[model samples]
Target chain A: MKETSLQNGLVERYIREVGRRLPQKQRDDVETELRSLILDALEARGDAVVDETPEEAQVAVLKELGAPEEVAGRYAAAPRYVIGPRLYDAYVRVVGIVLGAVALALVISTVINLFQTQPEGISILVTVGEFILQYISAAASALGFTTIIFVVLERTLSEEDLKDLKDETEWDPRTLPHVEDHDRIQPVGMVVNICLTILAIVLFNLFVDRLGIVFMQTEEGWRTIPMLSETALKTYLPLWNISWVMALALNIAVLQQRRWSTATRILELGVKVFTIYVLARMLAGPVPWLPFSSWAGDGMQIVESLLTQVFRWAMVFGIIGTVVEIGQSIYRMIRQR
Target chain B: MDEIINNLILELRRGTLMLSVLSQLRERQYGYSLKERLAEQGMDIDQGTLYPLLRRLEKQGLLSSEWDVSEARPRRYYVLSASGQEVLAAMITEWQQLVKVMEHLLPQA
Candidate 1:
């Protein structure tokens, strides 16, 4: 039977509308499927059946099935992982590396702290050093726990039947809708990071001043002062903290972009590691000045001991923070992929 | 009596529509031929509905289709994909069990 212009127009329009929503790889497949359905309906009604025009019948069938948009949506309703599988696998591998590094740092620092001693029978430096080591240990344990939970949830809760559906839905780079400038959330994330970093710095300074006398009585004495020095503070404190703030901002930007890339995700991770390193150096007293040698007189030995222990603990915290941050970044990157 | 019998038949077939479609698709058939065959078997499905269902099943990886353009008129022929075959095998096992249960429950013929 000769196809009428009206019937042809209806089929063409329907196919085009539906096809536009589908990925190019699957577009032809969907069109063929849709065409067969229309033809099948016409054939079932019979070639000689003349109650309704082909155009009218086609339109009626399309209407009952709903709009092309709605029909397309049903076929495309497959679940999307926030982090693609490849990224998730990468994240797990990277996090494992981070956790291992942190654990090693913790063990090494703990052993070193055990051997180090103070002049006075009970030195506050050792106490502080022990406290920081404990803190790192605790933080690492918490992160390890959380990662395990999330991984378990990902494996157990994910739908097994929808595996193919997940694979079929390709991440089309072109069709990824452009994010509007105003909709960007990076600025907000950076602002929050800066605010938090500032708060942390202020707290660190206050803690140092409160414990200044004790630090001075230790073997390393003036070395602990760099942790509170405004210049060293500015140099070391903000590096990774700023990077963290920026990483968070970039993550927000990525979210706004609506398309995930491994490059942006890795950059975000790099910033997180840099931030942790900066914080570690700040806590350990920036190396160039040899801040430990300046303290003098009768209390030099005590001050030296105190500063040494404090620096050691700071190193421990820094090491732990670096690992945790790396783990977090790797997890997020993999999850996003 | 005829109306009641028809409605019961529909309900019975409705539950087994997917299985019926899979069973028939052991041999390759296009959308039009599939609908005709089903109609001949007394399950008269609307073309609009069957086609979409077939597409959905194909998308789900239960069926696969390819166009046969060697003939003057090109037709899209669908058959059970590997995954579809596996699912069908499982479904048949369940169906046999169901049939045995029904046979035991029904009054002696």
Candidate 2:
């Protein structure tokens, strides 16, 4: 009787291990069927004798059936990989492009800082080390974020959407963009836009100190004057971050769909309006330029005034450009309808 | 060379394994009884592979199963569905044509 109980305990443990991995809907049925099958196999092996089946015989039968995980894996409904074959190509391309953009941005920022600081000897090496560390962290996070987007896409994209992506027979030449079609999403342009937007986000959020006009000064060597007043930047950084992130998300959506739709165009219109509001507020708020009078004495007074003029003109042009973009978006949306 | 041939053989058999399992389910059979029946006919399959495949086939609507509790221990019996019979018939016709094609294509042993 004790031996029989021991044999049943071994079988019960194995069943539990497999059932724990199976989906809830199938777990009970699979466990019941598996128990019956195991007992049947044991009987065939002459180990199901009422009170005498040895524990070793039970183990042997279970081993032949295979490991619990392997058995459960065969029963899994979902594919094992986070990003399956359907989205694999897009995932790889997006990660490569984003990581490349991040590395490029880091190198550009480091070069700009190097020129501004005129770092000598050990300082130059320290700057390069910092650049390397920043690139590693940026690239890692970019890969992670891109993977998460693809994982979400893998789960959410319907079969029809995937088929549209891959099936060459489904292609219709009539659907191709005309020569003057402004709504046709240019892949190369989208990539460049995404890269630039990401670079802006990284620079504004992380390396705001490096945004400045570099000037040569006699006797004092290279003088780095930090542009953009600290109070203004601190007030507006969150808004800028939100706008850039929204732009990044919109660009990714267009890239995935391979063309601009009415929905995305409407989204673009909304984003541009938000951006205009932020720019208008910044212009109306305190002067964003950092004047050099306190640090540079009376000799640099003219340079400070020239910098102020340049900053105001740049803001004016930025607002004008965004307004023109918003007009284009509305035109496209109306025409597309 | 032997390993390569073994793999090639395995690949060839993998497709036909589903047909072989389906053909036997014209009548109802419990899991072990079905496994033993196939083994008797010289088509030995692992319990691990056969059992999950049975569940998958049922999920695909090719087979229907029921639990018979009248026995000493309950056994789940699987039989061919109506659509399963249609698929089996079509598959048999395709297999026969494939066999004829192979016979003509291959040099006489």
Candidate 3:
């Protein structure tokens, strides 16, 4: 009897610990159920004599029962979320779409500036385009950020109502499903598509007109006709034009295939650095040897300076955005593991 | 194996816990004593799990508890509220029907 009492006491303490984490309303029922389970487990062991030392029995019972935290976690419902699983996934999807759209818009406006004949007009266009791109990107990011806040709030509120629901639903361990190996192809495919589209646009602008595609011009420099200006096409061009696309694509592909291997990540960083260098070169073009001649000859010097400044700022922002996205992807990969 | 037994036990608990708890509270009993009594009936309940259920039922106005300081060990005694009694009656009826259905399916010894 003394041995039984000791075993019972250990069981009681175990139950109490598990109960403390549970909501106040469902505490009693869950406690009762868990206590019965402990008793059942003890009975099944069947090793101890009735008169054995209580402490010894308790030690035996507890060892067999497993850790209190692990057992309690088993009984807990799938963890309540502020945003439900469905909503969280939806939120991520919507945010991705919004960012993609904003990027596309910025790319389109940049391409338009490249085509304008009037130097003064080009300067104004670049400034206006830069302002619009900044505003839209900020708005989209803010919208995405709000989804996280909403998820947190929803979880807190729902937890209150769900406290009493403990015994109604059977506890099942929640496990994230294994991500298939094939899923690695998605980011790689997106990167490749983006890069190819950009290259195609640049090549089309550069070679298409000389080859007789009327709207495209390659004579002085690669430029596209204003009428052919579409947001998707423009955004695709400047975005994929830089070396970052190759680096980002390779990194994402390697990261996906190899998980968090240090060598792959280092290579990714190298590619990013090289891409930045290329971007800087594109932003800061060759300095004019004869500024006065160019300024007086066609009055295009002022226009060129303004366009260069706008492009420089855009490239700087693009680099910042790319770095941020890379950092986020790396963090996500680690966390997902 | 233990896994199968645990799953079966968990399912049984999910279906009948509310009724078992409600029936026990028809008479006034404090949390600790109620748990002890249930254990004697081979339904050992952990205090960790029980306290929360009691509070929830109380919040829902299904059960009422009051601090009883009559004994040296002053404790809170809980009794079934009218609404709780009604719910318990409904749950008991549903359980009886379920038992009857299962009994019909089982072969007699």
Top candidate (TM-score): 2
TM-scores for candidates 1 onward, in order: 0.37, 0.58, 0.42
A110-169: candidate 2 lDDT, tens digit per residue: 766755665544564466578879999999998998888888887788888887787577
- Give the top-scoring candidate (lDDT): 2
Model 3 sits at a Cα RMSD from the real structure of 13.4
* lDDT per residue (tens digit) for residues A80-189 in model 1: 34444634765576667766666667667655655564322244345556656775776578567757765555555546543633567768899978765432346566
Instruction: Evaluate model 2: give its lDDT.
Output: 0.83
- Model-by-model DockQ, in order: 0.16, 0.57, 0.07
lDDT ranking from best candidate downward: 2, 1, 3
Count of residue pairs whose backbone atoms collide, per candidate: 22, 0, 19
Off by over 4 Å in 3: A1-298, A313-337, B1-8, B11-15, B97-109
Over 4 Å off in model 1, which ranges? Answer: A4-8, A43-48, A64-66, A80-337, B1-15, B44-49, B52-62, B81-83, B102-109
Model 3 chain A poorest 10 in a row by lDDT: A286-295
Better of 1 and 2 by DockQ: 2
Model 3: per-residue lDDT, tens digit, B1-109? 9999999998888666667789999999776667767878888655446654676678779999776557543456789999999999999898899999989999988
RMSD of 2: 17.6
lDDT of 3 by residue, A53-171 (tens): 65566567566556666655545553544567545665677777767766677656655654453233346446656657786767667675767665664555465465653357666
Which model scores highest in DockQ? 2
